[model samples]
Target: MWPWEHVAVGYIAYSLLSRTVVARRPGVPELFAVLLGSLGPDLIDKPLAWGLGVLPGGYSLGHSVFFAVPLALAAVGVAALAGRGSTGVAFGLSYLLHLPADVYYFVVFGDPPAYGILFWPLVPAAGGSIRGDLLSEALRYFTTFLADVTTPEAVPFLVGEALLLATAAFLLWRDTAARRRGRPEATTR
Candidate 1:
């Protein structure tokens, strides 16, 4: 999935979880944490793979449960020490959500389930080097994605994704506006 797709899924999931499970809306810090966590895997692995040629692929260390679990736990632990437990949870949940989102994306596109990508060194990625630097690779991928989404077969999925993103964006905007107004629910930490 693309970065924006990851962010949309993370925001939607976190927003619902925060309201239903925690009985509160997320704060600005928690929102920022979710955004960071949503892109953390790609930010780490993509540079290592596409720019430095260090990793086997763009889904190696950062996408793996081995690294993700420990990292999330450490983040939570540190944040708890700082008296921001919810922020930590938000980051951890968003980070973990990224793996399943990628797997789901692959499956939705008729690719085999990408469960192997979550195993990292244990199973190894279907390693392939992308051409050029990270920016170039991203542009190329985006171009391909645009082409794919233009197809009749992809219309329904595209429309659904667009709507989901729009809703997420609106929710974020509402939350930010509420924060500016100092609303009680939106003023948490």
Candidate 2:
């Protein structure tokens, strides 16, 4: 999945979790935190792989659950101790969601889940060294993704993508409506 897709999924998950678990909507800061978390892995790994050649592929390092789980837990622990538990939850959920999104992306592409990428140093990345500079690589990536999305095989992925977008839009609309009505739920922390 793309970075924006990851953000959408993370936000949707965080929103639903907030509503069900805490009976509250997240504030703007929490939404930002979730977006940051959703892109955290790619922000770290992509440059290293495509630009610096420090890793085998974009799926190494931050993509690893071995790294993410402990890091997210530490964030939660620190946040809890600091009395910012909601921020912690937002970060942790968004960070964790990246892994499954990747898996789902592969599955939708008719490939097996590349679970080995989740262990990094403990397990090898599936691909060889990234070719070309970062700009070229990014262009190729987006172009290929666009091409793929236009195919019949991508119909299910497109459907899922629409649902995610709709969910995010609905949440935003609901929040806006509640705020206009002066509902306390609109101001949840």
Candidate 2: Cα lDDT at 112 = 90
Question: What lDDT is reached at residue 74 by model 1?
Answer: 93
RMSD of each candidate?
Answer: 2.5, 2.5
Please give the distance, in angstroms, between residue 141's alpha carbon in candidate 1 and its true position after superposition: 1.8
Which tens-of-lDDT digit does each residue in 1-189 have in candidate 2?
Answer: 788789888888888887788787777767788988999888878888888888888888889988899988987888889988888889988999998888667877778987887888888874445755777777788998899999988898889889988988788677556666776353454
lDDT of 1 by residue, 77-131 (tens): 9999999988998899899999999877887677888899899999876545564
lDDT of each: 0.85, 0.81
Error of 2 at 131 (Å): 8.0
Instruction: Go through the candidates in order and give the clash count of each.
Output: 0, 0
Q: Which prediction has the highest TM-score against the true structure?
A: 1
